[model samples]
Target: MAKLFLLLFTLLNSSFLFSQENTLGNEYCQIQLISTEKSPSVNPPIKNLDKEQVTLLEIPAGKSRLRLNCRLDEQGVFTFGNDEILDVSWEALEVKLVPLAASSPSFLLPTGTFSIDFVFLTHHNYKQNFVWEPIVTFLNASLLNNITMGVFYGLCLTLILYVFFMGRVVGDTRFQFYSLYVFCAATFFLLQEGQLNIFLQQQSFLLSHQFYLLFAGFTVFTAIVFIVRLTDLNTTWPKLTRYGLEFGAVVVLLMSVLMLFLNHNELSALLGSAMARVTLLLMLGILTLVSIQAYRNVQSAKLVLLSLVLMVIAMVFRTVLHDVNPFLQRYSLIIAFAVEAFMLAVAVSERIKSIQTDKILAESQANTDALCNVLNRRGWDKKVNEILSEQKIKGGVICLLYIDLDNFKQINDKWGHDTGDKVLKVVSDIIRNQLRSIDSIGRVGGDEFVALGIFYDRTEAENLVIRIQKRLQAVSLHIDKQKTVEVSASVGHVIYEEPPKGAEVMLSQADQSMYQIKRASKQG
Candidate 1:
């Protein structure tokens, strides 16, 4: 009986020691990670783990999954830092958390020589802090990052909407392309910064990553197009701009297709980043060349060049120090983009203003007579119609004067065409000087001119015509040192207090009356 009691007591003591050794409590613990690549399940047994192949790691206070070879018999809160309770899975031995606050929750674990595996979903430097410090720091950084990105996106959205509306209003293709580029770049930054994942409930990291690449590709493509169009590269550097835009199109298509098949793996991420960098370099090179070529002649191109230079510098800095400063790496591009958008907006405005000015100048040139710098026949007709319409409405008298230079062909044949041209110019100057500023005068044909004047009565019209006829007759052209030639004009007038059938009828009546005066003058 004594031996049996001793044996039972020894067995119970040994069981208690074994249980104590297997239990894990609320303390800092190191874990071993095993890649279960060949295992049928992630929860492989400890017996399958090779001690030499396992890597030891400390647990972090963020979302992570782990496979442990031990089991938890008691339910306890698994805390990472302060008050945050991480989602723990005993069956799979996984903990997922986003440590928003500072607190570490205790976990009671049954210990054994178990295979454990951990995967962190958030990026953090493990050696920076031991407990909740890292989590707090990361959360703070993330908050700041989100705030900065949100403000940037808001500004970009405003610029995008403004440019889109302006593009429609101005009917400029360059504005449309620039707006598209801004939108794509804004979306790319949002995805790259994970803003979409936070705001859009349905968005995943993988989807955002894929879309980041897609918009990045489109942004480059559209930027190339915008530059080409804005600088008039098709006219300035035709072959190079054509080929560059074509290549950009192909790259865009290739990247878009690649996005469809991307799985968001490390290799894909690396390749996408490399492609983006290469595209950026290409764009910078092209823009630099274009800017240099156009800076002297194109004011808008200078602004565009400045914008590109700023963006390229920012991009190069980000690329160089991306691993060093997380905040700059993530947000520098957005800052650069904001500044560039402002500069580009100014460029677009200036370009539109230039276009409007040129259009007005072209219309003026189209309406003016080249020789006498007065209204041409087309302009005269337009003015006469306006006067007739005004007379009909306001009950005013308007007189149409049709004047022809007498024996003009004889003057041209005897004294030469140069003398005849001088005589016509002198006659135009006399008519212009005699008429009121409100009157319209035009050289309708060779040696034939018409004037429209407002008057109070028919006597006033007759007096004005007689004055113009006497002034034109007084004109003389010096053909050479030895001789001078004189010229005279036959004038006819028509007065209307009501709207005529049309300008054509008034013009025809004036022409017949002028021919009658010419015939009487010849007979006399």
Candidate 2:
């Protein structure tokens, strides 16, 4: 039983090895090429001959038509010396070939000799190599290409959706322009890579080529707009921004007109690519300059600068290093673009944060007194209104001390405005020091100030008022080496068990009491 089992296992292993060898042999086939002076539609001279009569032919450059003889044991897909792939029918005696354009011819084959006539739409200066493989190999290659293209498009679409929603949320035109730029860029790449051809089965080669140029033009145009808006280039780099915008607009217009009117030819394609590249360089230069100028003041500009630099490096690598690995060359731009989009998103978020901070600071400045760096009348009114509202709910005793500097005009006239300003700052500091953190103080007039605080009773309010008066009396300002100015203040106190209905009404009542004390002091 053991010997029989070993014998069966050995036979099975041998069979498997033999099958693998046969499969590999069938997968790879030999092809021979013969250039002919005859037109692509004409049959070559060696069709009726046996396999020995067919000589090994070398395919030379710049020839329009060639005869390709390939031997196959089974049906297979074959790629010609050019990049064109076609399906072969074993049963059909004659094969029909199609060319890229009207002037080109199709690759047609006859079954018996295993021979086909190949045509070229464009002449190449280098030698041509043909690929012959089983149909399964072709399918595998197609699947791989589909996966790569799908990943690229997926990333681009995600960025588009993200930026589109963010643009609407932030109400920023720059984000909108960036999203448009990304869409155009993705479309351009899809057309360039031939991924769109798979989906648009009815699209003609001419229309596809034209759409590629159109999207490329718009990509550069929108990128310029995005950078200009992001950096405020019109205001910061006026001359450069003006020139960049004009150049980008001209390039886009030329591409659009060319796509509509011009014939699809090598010359037109070259011109379109050249114009697009030049516009990209111009945009990069403008962004680099703007970033350098603004980076010191704007933190977000640093990220923008880094993204631009990364993109420029990727572009340079793709253009200059043509001999690099094919897979790396194909994906370098996609990777660079993804990194750049992420950085730009971060920069936009940072810009929004900065704007919010500036708004808060501006509000604070509007309500603050510039001279004393304390609350102005407007700020004090708002603060008192908040307090009054709170007191209405939780009724408590509140005290308002209205204080006025006596003979302030006389002191200002004698010592000059500079010394008068210094004296006011001293008074403001003294008032701030005397008040609790919860209390509020404001400058309502040139020489009048108000202090608001919570007190338990009339005795506590009177004690607080006396303390403030004593501090004001002790304050003195030195105007010069020869002179010192001293000032006195008249105080009026208003105590409320329940706060007034409005901050304005409370201020009015306090002002009247202050004037009564001022008049009585003048009489004394």
Q: For model 2, state the Cα shift of residue 444 in Å.
A: 2.4
Worst 10 residues of 2 by lDDT: 81-90
Name the 10 consecutive residues with the lowest summed lDDT in model 1: 77-86
Q: 240-315 in candidate 2: lDDT tens per residue?
A: 6777674666677576557656653556656665776687777667667767756566556677778888877777
Angstrom error of the Cα, residue 203, model 1: value is 3.7
Report the Cα lDDT for residue 487, model 1: 76
Error of 1 at 194 (Å): 4.8
Clash count for each candidate, listed in order shown? 7, 2
Q: How does each model score on lDDT?
A: 0.65, 0.66
**Against the hidden reference, what TM-scores do the models get?**
0.68, 0.68
TM-score of 2: 0.68
Instruction: State the lDDT at 389 in candidate 2.
Output: 78
